[model samples]
Target: MMLPLLEMTYKELADAFTEQYKKGPALAKALYGEFFKNLNPKAWQAEEIQASPGLADRLREDLSFSPGKIVDEIHQDGLTKFVTELADGVRIESVILPLKTHQTVCISSQVGCRMGCRFCETGKLGLARNLTVEEIIGQVYTARRRYGRSIRNVVFMGMGEPFDNFENVIQAVRVMSDQRGLNIAQRHITLSTAGRIDGIEKLAALNIPNLNLTVSLNAPNDDLRGRLMPIHNTVSMVRLQQALRAYPLKKGNWLSIVYVLIPDVNNGPEHARQLADWLQPLRAKVNLIPFNPGKNAPFRAPHETEIDSFRRQLIARQIQVQKRAPRGRDLMAACGQLGSGIRQQGLN
Candidate 1:
């Protein structure tokens, strides 16, 4: 089987090159240092490499090449969403948000999700399969190539429960952040999970630097959370709390507790208070995400008055909290708004 060169970490790239070609690390560095930094498709065709003629062509042709093609695109309100088709014909959506100072790409780790979060459109599709490391990184590669600017940040917040596809996600992170590859700073990447406690424990044990973790704690208690998120059935709030407490974080840095405010569902003064009490023991900052409109979901976004009241309640309890303004809603590219049109196309 061919190695997905674009998805390999520096160590993996070097080791693979030596094992396959009987060459030293210099060849691997020479190839990746050029391709990753520039992302030029033509680089492999260059004739100046310290290798046999046609070697680059042979390597490119044989390997599982191409990061997938951008089959569809939607741009609105400064957010651009791209639908890419992978080699096996599976499709995924990636979003690019042009912030004031930088661009953030929300990439997916799976074709569809099985978590079955009531608010998420992705969950409605059910699980197809976990994305390979290359397929995950391919989103970033395609975005960078199309936009012609360096991607400043990336979020694993697009279409799947990241921790469910833990190994590929971690491998993709390493390759994307490698000094020889995309070189995205560890701090610039954020992995959001729907309270996957096992994944949280694994990440804590890794003790990687500058990589941020966010848990989608949409409910204040187990009963309400279980109704909203099916993962809560197995990974209870109490178990999730234990895992979060065990997570090693820098002393002042807090874990992001993402609470999607579903009107009349998980949004109330009592819910806010319970949330505050739940987070009191851990270092956490609550991010209040107003629910985005979804075709199948019955919930609605909380009123601004309710949102403010909820924030104030958490503030009164001395819990750090902030409201996340909705983005890319017009294009259905915002949080809980992805997974549109793929089912109709039968990619899942």
Candidate 2:
């Protein structure tokens, strides 16, 4: 089988070039620049390839470049949710979020989610499979090259629980943050998880520089959280908090705790106090997301007054909190709103 060009990191690509073609690191660097920076596949045919003989033919014979095709693009208020059909016909949705300065692409780590969060639309569709490295990176590439998006940040908060597909997600991150390739700074990349302790420990061991970790913590107490998120049944809030505390965060960096404020379910004053108390020990900020009601959603969004009151309650307890504004709701691309609707329609 031919090696996947998109899956290989700079070091692996360099080693491949040196071992297969007896080319130096410079050739690998040039090839990496052409493939990732320049977004060119035929780097060996470019003028820079003069230094490395037979490199073009070697790449042609030994490497494969396959990217998912964008079948649908749904545009809403400054957000475009694009669906990419993979080689195996499994489809995934990714959202292009418009920030003030630069764009952020919310990419999926799996086709459907197994986390089974009661409030999320993606959880409605059971896990199909984990996306390969190419499929993961292809989302960003398609956003940048095909749609002409100026993507500055990437978030793993789209479809599946990122830590469940830990190896592939981390490999994709390495390929993305490679200086010679996508070159997205580690600080610009955010991996959101639904409280997976083992994955948290593994991430701490790898210690990717400046990578931001966001925990999808909806409820404050164990009983409420377990009811809202099934993952809590296995990984409790206590263990999750311990893992977060052990995570090696650089100076000036803090964890982002995402609390999806479902009306009456997890938005009461007592819930807010419990959440604040739970977060008292950690250097973390709360991103309060008012639930975006999806199809057949069991919970409704909190009223504006309730949302404000919850925020104020946290603030009163000296917690740093920011209310997340809902984006791409009409298009079903908002937080906890991504699902497999397009795939079910057989759009591919």
Candidate 3:
């Protein structure tokens, strides 16, 4: 059984090196640096590797660098969607969005999803399995390498509900934010959940610094929310709102509440007013996503006028809100548009 080098945090790698090779933290730091620099054992040229005889060879022999391979990639409208096939042949999709200044990578936390949100393509597949820490981090590394862009932001908003795969997702975040590794700042990482109260409470208890939390809150009340998101049946909107209010947010940082505007469903002005009232207790900004219809989508996207009206209603209520323009819809890379191909292929 080989240990995954990418799965270990800097401290864990350093401790392992100190315990097994009698090398201090300096050597471990150098090795860790080299591993992330090229993500290839053969590309290592750190001075520490040359100074310590057989150290590089020993690392290659002991540790495994298996981030899987990018099997498919698609580019459309400034968005790139890439699929990585794991060693076990399970495939997951990740997207790279071109931001104004820097790029952002959206990574998956699980293979498919169990939280059957009515608008999500991934939810239709049901739950396959949670991604490992290596698998989750591997998407970022592979995307960065292939796209050749500096990824300044990372969002757990690709395939599955992040909070459902809590441990692996958190471990991946720790490794990604470590200065010696991916070096992405904690503030740059965002974890989006489908309103899982247990996961919400667990994350609040962790109190991770500067980490952004987004809740997929499509509806304002329990009746409508339950129809849109099956998770609402287990965790009511009131309870979810209570958890969000209790979450420790840094100064000037507010939670993101994502509302998918499905036409004739939850896109009415009354719904917007109710949403504003629901959000009154928490520090949250609403991101209005005009529904991107997936294959056999139960509902159509709201018209531009309807979207504008909904935004106006929220604004009139003094709720901070922003309408997210649909991106990568042609490539099926937009919100609620991932996992259909995999599901159709019977991969899940």
What TM-score do all the candidates reach, one by one?
A: 0.95, 0.96, 0.97
lDDT of 1 by residue, 200-303 (tens): 99999889857899999999899999999998988777888999888888766778989988888987788988999999899989999889976656877678
Report the number of the highest-TM-score candidate.
Answer: 3
Model 2 regions lying over 4 Å from their true place: 50-53, 343-348
Tell me the whole-model lDDT of each prediction, alpha carbons only. 0.84, 0.87, 0.87
Candidate 1 Cα lDDT to native: 0.84
- State the lDDT at 244 in candidate 1: 89
Better of 1 and 2 by lDDT: 2
Q: Weakest 10 consecutive residues, lDDT, candidate 1?
A: 41-50
Residue-level lDDT tens digits of model 2 in 1-348:
466878989999888877877878987888788788888766666566755566577677776777788888988899999888899887899999888888999999998988899999888887989989988998887788865547979999999999999999999999999988988899999999999999999999998859999999999999999999998998777888889889999999999999999887988888988999899989999999989997778888788898899999999999999998887678899998887465356433
Candidate 1 — which pairs collide? none
Error of 1 at 136 (Å): 0.3
Instruction: State the lDDT at 14 in candidate 3.
Output: 81
Model 3, runs deviating above 4 Å = 41-45
Candidate 3, overall lDDT? Answer: 0.87
